[model samples]
Target: MMISETLNCGAIVTTSQKGKGDLIPRAKGAAKLLRIPYVERKRLSLANLQANHKNKDILIFSQKGPQLFTGEGKAHEFHLSMAQLRLIAYDRGETDHLVEALGPEAISSFLDCTAGLGSDSLVVAYAKRSCKKMVALEGNPLLAYITNYGLRHFVHENDTVTAALRRIQVCAVRFETFLQRAKDDSFDVVYFDPMFEVPVTESPQFLSLRGHLVESGFTEAILREAKRVAKERVIVKERPFSSIFQTMEPDELLGGKYSRVAYGVYKVKG
Candidate 1:
């Protein structure tokens, strides 16, 4: 079978010549998963790649960690402690819209269909420690690999936070495909936080992620599958008055003042 130009166009996996032996295998595996070539070299100059291959990107493995870089001179890597600040705020009595949307009760399991950066998933894992099984699926392999690495390696001062982060299981697969094979009522709650239809262009953080972000949005078919796999309810996070909400009316809505995120919860019918 011929590989599409798109597969090889933007990215090739590479490892630092001085990269640890243990980390080298992961770099090769990343290349294989993305169906891109793995190049082992002494060093990678992102600036040179930007000038040389206009469309090409690089995922470099080093002793520090795996990082994805676009020729645009920006790098996207997973921060293991990304959710720590959020959790801390919650601990200090901040009302987390996502946690509130899930209700106060402890759920046994969670399935995050669109685990962009795995931020929300980490928060859910921390909040619902009683519900220890948290699985996140990312359609973008690069994002998934980075998140998986962070989850395993990120250390935290708080034992509970560290444990929660470690417990999350991230898989590189399309949510639709994963939902199809999931048994009925496999998880207590299914969550979706797809990329906003209106991108946050003003935010440098989100803008940096633009290159690696998956552009797909949710559809009725996906919602249907999510409902089937969720034993409790399926929750969606989006901005207010999103067109998607009109198409798929949720049974409940949860939001807060000055909050950009809102939730649409569709309870599973017994």
Candidate 2:
């Protein structure tokens, strides 16, 4: 969803603290970036929600980290389930298709053009322990905030996983804008996981993420820029039968027959 749409519906950014004056300044700063009003409350309570913004939807900056409440009692928070899945697959000695397509060991620097909740980005970062740098660009401020918070704070039983999560640098910026300024071969690989053009009932995670998303579907311009910025390869993830894949015509395709997800790859030419 667009930021304007979110603000128009009545939203305020604040801290969950009961009376933390120090948090107010930071909350206000983030509020400015999100273009939402800033309000300070001693405690983030149901009564406070009913009183302050008149029960408007809330974006809270707290000790636990960033979160968005739809006001319908549904809370949107970042989770590292995908990253953890990758670790499990690795333990079983099975390779994720995205890693198979990217040629894992060759990836030292990676760029994720559409970060969303940063699941895919975290997956690759965790898989390639030799990776030196991993940057994920998220266009939506709310998602970026929540994802960044998760990356920094989420703890795993494995220290390596914790280190991998910390290695990612999440930035709130549009993919096209980032690509325009990115130098040639700026990263060893670039990745995109655009929202599907057609709805898939199987995708409950995306369905639950309705209004919380920015609508930047796959586009030729994005792919072109990604190719220019990536040194070795660019990968796009989408449903295999999606029309976008027909036009995308990736140089290499990965994912099993029973798998619903597909990867479209483009290798940079010499």
Best by TM-score: 1
Worst lDDT run of 10 residues, candidate 1, spans: 1-10
| TM values, all candidates | 0.88, 0.85
lDDT of each: 0.77, 0.76
Error of 2 at 65 (Å): 2.1
Would you give me the overall lDDT of model 1?
A: 0.77
TM-score: model 2 vs. ground truth: 0.85
The sequence of per-residue lDDT tens digits that candidate 1 reaches over residues 1-270 is: 111112433467777656777777888877776787776654646666445545466787877788877654467777743466789898999988889888877899999888867789889988888987888888767667777888888888888988888888887777877899999989999999888876545545456567566666799998888888998899998877788888888898888866566899998974
**Candidate 2 deviant stretches above 4 angstroms:** 1-11, 17-26, 32-35, 41-57, 202-204
Clashing residue pairs, candidate 1? 10-57
**How many residue pairs of model 2 clash at the backbone?**
2
